[model samples]
Target: MRRADRLFQIVQYLRGGRLVTAHMLAERLEVSDRTIYRDIADLQSTGVPIDGEAGVGYILREGFDLPPLMFTRDEIVALVAGARMVRAYGGPAMARAAEEALVKISAVLPDTERARIDRTEIHMPLWVVSEEERRTIDTLERAVEARHVLKIDYRDEAGASSCRDIRPLGLWFWGKVWTVVGWCELRGDFRAFRIDRIASITCDGRVFKHERGKQLADFYRQMERDEAARDWAHRRSQNAP
Candidate 1:
């Protein structure tokens, strides 16, 4: 987590006049107690009204609040709708983060905007994504961020099963389906594997560095070229007829 986000979380935990210990904060933020102490000191130095010592618990005094966030109605609707979609279709950790983001956004917004958020009619059905697929997506997402190599047992559309070692590049969501775009060591090219079709996936404890042709940008370029070729072929067929 970024320092700024950690500090914000500290303040959020300290709200409602609740006393939160540095150890507790450390555990929650996955940081050391000393780090939490320093963060608290820094927050206090910034005139954040956080009152507490090293060992004792810290509390945000009553009436303390973050500045109201400004958002137009359309922007608010978009934000709320997107968050709701993620909460329904995203991974477990992502869902929790989305919920917390909604809470934080609501906390900083003016009452009118906050009410608009509640009134936003957009929602997503949670049943569309299976729990297993959600977990796979979360794992693939982490691997993409960390540049980890993964071994996956994948079943293609033709029902052939194969295990491939892949350098995870990125995840693409096609409305109802989720696919991981990766550099396939077996095929020596980019392959998009559907998350639901992956029977098993495990990290190989090895990381990969970005290569010229094996990157996500290269995959996108290849896709564009393929699309253009298809369009050209269709145009030629129409002209021939």
Candidate 2:
């Protein structure tokens, strides 16, 4: 990876709570410690809020945000690769978001860099599926980002349809599908709706608040427990025969 790209990765890694060492960055970016140090200097010179000590690991300043501009070549590669993966496996909204993000990235890049991004190839096959599920994922993602309420028309595996008003907590991408985990007003409980099974969605134009990460974690744990119980019951029923 280039020095500029390595610097961007370091910034993101630090933002994600990783304690990055010069040696570690060296290994990860296929460069020497000296090169890593130079890259760090470049970042610091360019106004990135990276901090570190002699023996302790480096970190980004608390609440430090990535600049709205500036992306390195390797960083572009990673973004393209990830976006392509999302386009392949994520729901329609995510794929569209990936495309939009790439466009934004290109807009921010310098002319030469923008041309390079356009020419770079990171290929991935997308799912050949109908787009009926697209709008729900799009609205759910907006709700998650903006902390808004969504009116949902959903169906379960049994094909029972129900209308619900929900305060979306977050979105989940698992098992090649998108799920919205939210506080459902109809059920008076936190619920997860499969994006593909959602028949319709409308934003209520009202925002709600909850512990975002904690709520998602709790929902995932409950889902795991429910799945486990079903597996155990299936085994017991099979043995009873």
Candidate 3:
């Protein structure tokens, strides 16, 4: 679990004037007692109203409540517009989660901010992406998260078909299409397959480990280098005259 999430859980466990022990918090959060102690100290330093020490126990003082979320006007507009786009173009589970996020944002915002969300003019046509492609996207997303090796039958733009076993690294959305970028076992290199061009994809029940020069960071670095090379070539061509 993320440290932020663990800290939040620690706070929740100490609520209602309950004296929660460091050991108890550690066990519940699957972390060390030292981590809980550090977290408690950090929370105390941040004026979280946590009372008590490492050995004894800790309690969140009564009347202490988390502050409401605050967002600037531009932040609200961007969030609402992005959520609407995801709801329209993302997978079924993704769409539902985006909808819930929008609802939660609206529920927490002040009345004026909530009104701004409704007034945000950005919208997306729901029919732009087919249901089949959405399902494919969902599958690939799960595979990427799980670090699973996927066996995919893909047809390229020129109608060439090939089956590949790939270590799913990440998904990239290019406005209208979704592409799964992975380290292709067949090609012995990184390859990106469009979701629409994927005829079939299934997990091979094999999880992959991060290897040197094959991870997502490596892919991004490669992309940056390629882009820089293209820019240099463009500049060279323009200066030729």
Q: What's the TM-score of each model vs. the native?
A: 0.77, 0.50, 0.80
List, residue by residue over 132-216, the lDDT tens digit for candidate 2: 6555566677778888878878889999999999888887777567777887889877887888888888875887767554466
Order of candidate numbers by TM-score, starting with the best? 3, 1, 2
Per-residue lDDT of candidate 3, residues 165-228 (tens digit): 9998988899898988999999898998898999998775999999999999999999999999
**List of clashing residue pairs for candidate 3:** none
- Name the regions of candidate 3 deviating beyond 4 angstroms: 13-34, 51-58, 224-241
lDDT of 1 by residue, 133-228 (tens): 999889998999999999999999999999999999988889999999899999999999999999999886899999999998999999999999
The C-alpha local distance difference test score for the whole of candidate 2 amounts to: 0.77
**TM-score for candidate 3:** 0.80
Residue 65, model 2, lDDT: 73
The segments of candidate 2 whose C-alpha lies over 4 angstroms from its true place after superposition are 1-76, 87-97, 100-121, 127-129, 211-214, 220-241
RMSD each, Å: 4.2, 12.5, 3.2
Worst 10 residues of 1 by lDDT: 104-113
Which candidate comes out best when scored by lDDT? 1
lDDT of 1: 0.91
- Of candidates 3 and 2, the better by TM-score: 3
- List clash counts for every candidate, in order: 0, 0, 0
